[model samples]
Every structure is written in structure tokens, then in C-alpha cells.
Target: MPAPVLLPPTSYDYVTVHKVQGTTITAASDILAAEEPLEIRLGFGPTGQREHRTLAITMRTPGHDFELAAGFLLTEGIISRRQELHGILYCPDVEKVEERENVVRAELASTVPVALPRLERHFYTSSSCGVCGKTSIEAVQAAACPVLPTDGPYVAAELLHQLPERLRAQQELFEQTGGLHAAALFSPEGELLLLREDVGRHNALDKVIGAALLQEWLPLHQHVLLVSGRVSFELVQKAAVAGIAVLAAVGAPSSLAVQAAHNFGLTVCGFLRQGRYNVYSHPWRIVGAATAGL
Candidate 1:
């Protein structure tokens, strides 16, 4: 059978809608954040013996498909170092010229190994939640991901409150459709390193991490990850895999997310809006957190 052809993502769609104010109704055009399936495939094996196999299909806002594929692979423990990856490319079959660029084939270094059985087990992830219906922390930890480092780069309470606003300002897609998730990576000095938006919060984050990985920025021990919405276990797990020190969310976090953060030594903060936020774990990273708790 022929391999599946992945197509490029459509970031948004234009459609007509009705607007009602008081008692009057009017028709108008509106924009929507585009959502589409992105199939991630891994290409591995000896030179002429290399082959392509589907890894996972996720719904994400179109654009940055390659970064998303790379990030997903990294967080999934499939590939770690940028050196381990050769390149993520679009299929170049002259016969399939009309194919959408959504399908990405990640070619790993010939020296890098491929674990087919383990890779297949994680192909069922969705855009909504990385750990949907997942039983325990162990289920998420099956990736053999490393623990996050707990050192310097302690952020200030003032900065933590400012992250949501910083992330919000960079949300270009959300500004247009008011319907997209954003994930941003920030330096300890509160500098925005990368920002990515997606229909799924998890996918948005994957793009951010993928971008960093593509640039050989793994083991982000001095970095902070800010998401536009609530944090989930999957998000924390992904951060841990990348060695992020801090994970902050604009909204609340799930119990599992808190536990994951606590377990992995990641500082998880949530409800990060209106100049107030809660530190779920590793409160020491936030300046004066102990004083705040008192």
C-alpha cells in the first residue's frame, strides 16, 4: 500500500455569521482559526533501507507543521538532540504535486535508533488532551523522559503576572478569530523566545517546543513556558521532557498537572491573570513566594 500523503494546514477559515444586538439581526463575515489534521511520520533505518511510518495525527492551527512534528517527537522521547534529527521535510513526489503539505516526514540521523513498537503506542494522542482518559502518571511517564532541573532563573511575582499579558499580546491568531490556544517560551529575563498558536493547547505548546528543539535549544532549564489556557498533565510532561523550569498557565491547572509538576520538579503556576496567580509546586522559583504564602 502507498504511504499516506500529509497536506499543509489551513490556519483559519472565512465564513458568514449572524450578529444580534437587542432585537435586530444582521449577516456578516467572520474568520475562524483553521483546524486540520497533521500527520507526523518518522523516517529511519539504514541508508537505502530507510522507510516512512506514521507517528501521530494531531489537529492544529496551520503553519509551523515541521516544528510541531519535531517538538512532538522530542517530547514523546522519540528524538532528543537536534543532532539526532536530519531534517523534517515535505514529500517531494513530483507525481503528488497537488498534495497538501500537512504530512511531514522526519528523517533521523542514521545513527539514531527507532523504536517502532513504542512509537506506535503513542500515535493515538489527540489535539484536545495529550493524556485523554489516561489512567496514571506512569502512563504519561512511559516516554522515558528526563526530570526537569531545579536551579536558578527564579522569576519574580511581578513577571509571573505579566506572562499572560505578554502571551496575550503575541497571540496574533487569537486576535483575529478570538479562538486559538497559544504557547510561548520565555527566557529567565522574561524575554519571549518563541510563540505558537493552535486549535489545541497541546499542539500550540508542541510547536513552541519544536521550534526550540529545531534550534538545538533542548534542556530548557533556564526557560519558562507560558500557555494561553489551563495547564494539563500532558503539558507539564512535555515541559519536563524539554527540561523547562517553569510552566505557567493563564487559567487553572488540573490536579494531575499539579502532581506532574511536583513530581518532575517543574514549577507550575496557574490562574495567572489579573495580577494574581497560584503556584502549585516548587514555589521557591517565584520570588517572595514564601512571603506570599505567609
Candidate 2:
């Protein structure tokens, strides 16, 4: 069989590091979450008339890069469905072997137009709150996908309490380096579906979403998304675009994150630990939550 195209060589799995104590010195190795810059390119239009363009370069931990690129496109409102993509390939150029694994090219349908200018502005754009350029409530609405209702999929309070442990158990990289962030997808019954880790929290979210897109599992209304860190408006926006109903974070939620969750009708749960956690917005989906605590 031919070489598997998507499975590029991993750069670093573990590295050697030194440890020190007050009066003793020991040598040991540490697992590092490898950080690298990945360039995402888009190939649009049909055969013989395709236009290829550079999209963005993001710093991310290696692995699941193709998924990261795909998920990034989908959550950014670039491509909606799996069919919109024709293929994803490592840069086929023989001359650039050094970056052959670092670069990924997304082959989009000819009918699709690459929204580089808008995406460029959005990718580089930073906002104190809300999504890229989604400054006001109206602007957020205009830029986002249609809000998925927060009804149905009643997640038990007990299940919410266990999500952090479940998500952390599957974090292979975090257990090693204690440096990377993870985004995990779980079913309503609290089963782990997928977990992605990266140095960048947003990249981890993108990686998980990309995995879902590849599996044709968009519109995750019946599922829950858990991130390793605090909730941000961008994370909320990504989950909203993917139609995820419940978003849980081990850390707290930013003010705009709660606002975005509230505006989009998503259930935002934060500070999730053994017993105590806070519900920031749309508590309806968390069943029996009010009976337990405020």
C-alpha cells in the first residue's frame, strides 16, 4: 500500500530535562508538548481553474494537524460541511522537504470561494471580548452560525462533576508535560468521544472540532464539549458554530464567554471540580442543578 498521507512524522514525543532539589541534583527526562508553526493553505475553484492561496500560520503542538486545519475552517465559517472539502494533503512539493510535514493544504471544492481577506482579518483580529469583530450582540449574531437551542440533552449534575476527571484521564500529553491544554468531546451519557491537546487552547478546540468534522459529526447538539482551561468567547463561539449545547471548563469563564453563551443559548459551566462548580449561562440543560446549588 502507499504511504498514509495524513500520518506525518511526529517531531518530539519526549525530551531530556534536568531536575534540582535543595541539596541534590538528578537527571531525568520530561515529555514536552512540541510546539510548531503550521501553515494552512486553501485550494479553491475547479480543475484547471483552481486558485491556491496561503491562509494562516498558527503555533500548535504537533499531531492532528489536518484536523486542526479543517476544524479551524469550519468554526471560522469558511466551510460548513464535509463535502465542501475535496482533500487534505501534506505539501507535495519535493523542494520543501524541511516543511513538508509542517504545512498542510486543504483542497476545497471549485464552487467554494476562499475567504482569505475576511478570515485573515478575523484570524489576526483580537478583541477584548466576543468573537473576532463580533463586538456587539448584533455583531456576534451576524458572524456566528444559527444558535442551537439549549433544550433537551439533560446532563445530570453528577455527570458534570465527573467531566473534568474524565477529560483529564484521556489527556495523554498533559499527564506528561503538564503544559498543554486539551479539548474533549463527550456524549450526553458522559462517554469520551475524542480528545485533542495543544499548547494553544484554541488550537486544541480547533483540533477536536476538526476531528468531528472529519467524522461528519457536526451539529453536536446532543453532545458536550469540555476544555482544560477557562472558557473564552472564542471557545464558546467555536462550540456554538458546531452546534454544541453544553460547554464545560475546568477553569472559570470570561465575562464575554458567559455573554456569548447566554446570547447563543448555550449552557456554560465553569470552575468544574469535585463538588463545587459555577453555572454562568443557560442552566436549563443541566438537569436538577437548581435543586443542588445556586
Candidate 3:
């Protein structure tokens, strides 16, 4: 196994001034940079077998790299849970550091092929745009998974309205650079369970899901997920795979996300700010909210 190459952090230079003895004096500056890369690699092989097959590569910030890999595999329907991942390691055969590039290969327990569509919509070098590789809206419809419901949980208006702030407060990267997106999970009681942040919104969700998988908490059927960005079809898809019943977004959801939620019987809420939000699907879960006024 090859050692993980961690990238450095991003930083910015700043200066401060002081006024003493009726005179102004100024200090200096600093340098800042963050760890970021595109990890690329292939799928599973025999236990002692090591044949490299081209899987997928994604450009991302470097912390929790393993989680990123596992999450990518799970969300793509490649593997269902953390147990499916036998091992994840860099290709040690390559000699030169440059050869490593942004590649990371994951080995699964089985020799099965991932069942996702052949379309390349999910692969991307960046997250500025959400799920940019699909062929058509109808294609998404075809892959639209069935929703499973257990019990309907009601969320209070005050708690539903305050999720954005709680999610925002947990985003350390956003607080510093103001450039990242975040995703969080909360119990039905509105207790914050876990949170993740990334340069991309989808990646943020993946990291959170990946963490949950590592913890053996899949099919988040009883949990509520919140996103710092808008809700998209892909985000809804990810939520569905995690079995999350409710998805709240700080921004508005696209038409496709709404449709996906409707088809899957998910609870989708957007524009979650200023004590207001719009429910796109399964509105019954969000009880006692002043939704009519919105």
C-alpha cells in the first residue's frame, strides 16, 4: 500500500494596524493554501490479486480522502455499505511521485460490476455545477429509486427554521474562506448528529454519508439531512440511498430535485432561511410549521 500524500492547507495574508503616540503603525502579512486534489483509480480484485481496472476519478480537497472514496462508491450504487470496501490504497507499483497524480483505487469484497447507468453525468473535475454528467432528465427518472417509509416524524416550525444557522455554525472551512458548502444530519428531535464541509456541495453530502457508512449507520431512515446549498436531483438521490426522510436546503431546489422527491416520497424543503421554507414532497413530516403563510 502506498502512503497517503496529504496536501497542505490554504491560507491568506492579512495585516493589522496600531495607533500609538498619535502615529499609525502597520504589521506584515502571511501565506495560506489548502490540501486539494483529484483522486483517480479502479475497482475490486482478488484478495491477493492486484489488477488495476479504471474506475472513476474526482478532484476534491484532501482531508478524509478515504471517506471520499467509500462515499463515491456507495452513492454510485457500486457498493451499499462500508463492509463492501475491502481495502483502499494508493497504487504502490508506480515509482515516481508524479505517477501517483490524483489516483486512488478501492478494492471491494466481491467481483461484481457496479449497477449504475453508463452515463458520465456523475463524474466531474469540479463541484461548481451539481451532477453535470447525466444524459437527460428522463434517464434520471429511469434510475429513480423506490422510497421506503417507516414512521412519519413531525418537525416543529421553530426547529425547522433554525437548521440553517446550526449547520452554518459547524462549518469551519466556510467560516474561514467562505467558499465551502456543508451537509449535516440531525435526529428527529433536532439534535445535530454529524456534519461535513467541502468545496463542493455534493462532496460535502458524500463525506457525511461516508462517515455514516463507516459508523455502520446506513439507510438513515430515521435521520434528517440538511444542506447548505440548493437541493438538486443528485442530492436527493444521495439522500434516498442513505434512507434519509427529510432534506432541508439553504437555497432552492431545482425542478428535477422536486420531481425526484415526489417520485420517491421524500420530504424536500428549500429556501430554509428567515423562518420560512417550501416543502416539495411528503409535507406531512414537517408538522406544525407555518407553511401556509409562505
Candidate 4:
């Protein structure tokens, strides 16, 4: 394989639309989030005899695709570290010119083992659903996701309060189309480190994690992760797998998400806005929280 080419895909597209308000219709241009299927392929086996397999196909906005592929593989337990990956590149032999950028191939080092049967459940994923394609509950718990350490990255309530506004301000695509979800990485002191956007919340986080992994920043035990929307079990699982200490969201968290967070010893904060938020589990990580009664 040749050196991977970085082709920037358009994240949004403009279309002519009729604006109707109070029965008055006017033609105007509207921006919409671009959703397309990204095919993630893996090349594994040995140096002399490598095998290619289609790993997954996800519906996501077309940008930062390389990061998305790397992140997906990491969260899915395909490759645990950046060293396991040989390279990630667009498929050079795509059948169509327009589809060249739609496919990404992740080359894995021969030293890495391949387990295709365990990952069959992830054949197809949509923008709206992350883990719905799961075949069994056992499969979901089988990944080698670690339990987070109890050490302190102790974040202040005041610092947490300011994160949503900071995350919102950096969401360039969301500001334009209002149809994209975002995932951001923040320091314990509330500094915005990195942000990724996509039609699917999972993909956005994958891109963020992928970038971190590529940049050799795994085991994010001292960092914070914030998502734009409600928290799901898949999101919790991903955050934990990446070794994120605190997972915050602008909206509420699901019951399973809270349970998983508690089990993994991760700090979960939901409804994080308006100078207040709910700490669902492991409140001890939040500085000045009274953990005596609970």
C-alpha cells in the first residue's frame, strides 16, 4: 500500500430551500449535515500473506474519516494501541471516483491478532444508533475495557460549569447546520483540548479518540470527555475503554449508562449547564462534593 493521502471531505452541503413562516414562503439557501456510509476495512494476518476484511460500515458526516476509522477500531477492541496499526489510508482501488473518499483501510501490524468472529455484530451502524446492532449482551461486556482508577483529577464545579459554553463555541459545523453532534476533550481545569463533529455522537467521539490515539495519547486517565447530547451505554463504554476519568454530557444519561459508569469507577456528570449539573456516579472525583451520605 502507498502512503495514505489525506483528502478532506465536505462536512456540510448547501441546498436551495423554501423558507415558510406564517404562510409567507421565500426561497433561501440552507446548510445540511452531510451523511454518508464510511466503509472501514482491516488488513491483518502476516507480512508475506496478509488478509483483507471489511470491518464495519457506518453512516457519518464525511470529515476526519481517518480518525474515525482509528477510533472505531480502538473502541471496538480491534486494536488497543497506536503501535498495533501500520497505517490508515483511503482505499486506492475504489470502484468509483466519488467513492474513493468513502472507504478507509486500516493496516494492522502482523504482530497484532485478528478476531473477526467476535466483531461480526458491527457489520452496519447508523447515525442514530450506536450499539443497537449488538447481537448479545455478553458480547458487549466481553471487550477488555478496564476499570478506571480512583485517583484524583479532581475537577471543580466551577470548571465543569464553563465547559458547555466552551464546547459550543468551538462547534463550527453545528453553528452552521445545527444538525451535527460534537465530542470534546477537556483538561481537568476546563481547557478545551480537542473537538470532533459528526452526524452521529458515537462517530464524533471516535474521531476525537482516534486523533488522541494517533497522537499517542491513550489511557486518558487525567482528562475529561464531554458529549453534546444524552449519554448512552456505548458512549460510556467508549470513554472507559479510552481510560477517560470523567465523562460529562450536556443532556441526561440512560440507566444502563449510569450503571456502567458506576461499575467502571468513572465519574459521570449529566445535564451540565446553567451553572449546575447532576453527578450520577462517583461524585468523589468532583472537588468539594460531599460523599459522606451517599
Best by lDDT: 4
lDDT of 4: 0.85
Candidate number with greatest TM-score: 4
Model 2: colliding residue pairs: 45-110
Write one digit per residue (lDDT tens) for candidate 4, span 244-287: 98999999998888888777788999998887899999988898
Give lDDT tens digits, candidate 2, residues 220-291. 888999998999888888888888989999899988778888888899999998687888888878876556
Task: Please give the TM-score that candidate 1 achieves against the real structure.
Answer: 0.90
TM-score of each: 0.90, 0.89, 0.78, 0.91
Over 1-294, each residue of candidate 3 has an lDDT whose tens digit, in order, gives 122223335322233435355575555343222435655465655556655555555546556656777777776666766677777777766666864645677777765455334314445433334443344334444453335574665677578877777777666666756666788998887888887777767777888888888888887888889999889888988788777888999899988888877777789999988877778888888877543445
lDDT of 3: 0.69
lDDT of each: 0.80, 0.79, 0.69, 0.85
Q: Tell me how many clashing residue pairs each candidate has.
A: 10, 1, 13, 0
Worst 10 residues of 3 by lDDT: 1-10
Model 1 Cα lDDT, one tens digit per residue, 153-177? 6988787877777777767678889
Assess candidate 2 and give its TM-score to the true structure.
Answer: 0.89
Off by over 4 Å in 1: 1-9, 93-98, 127-144, 289-293
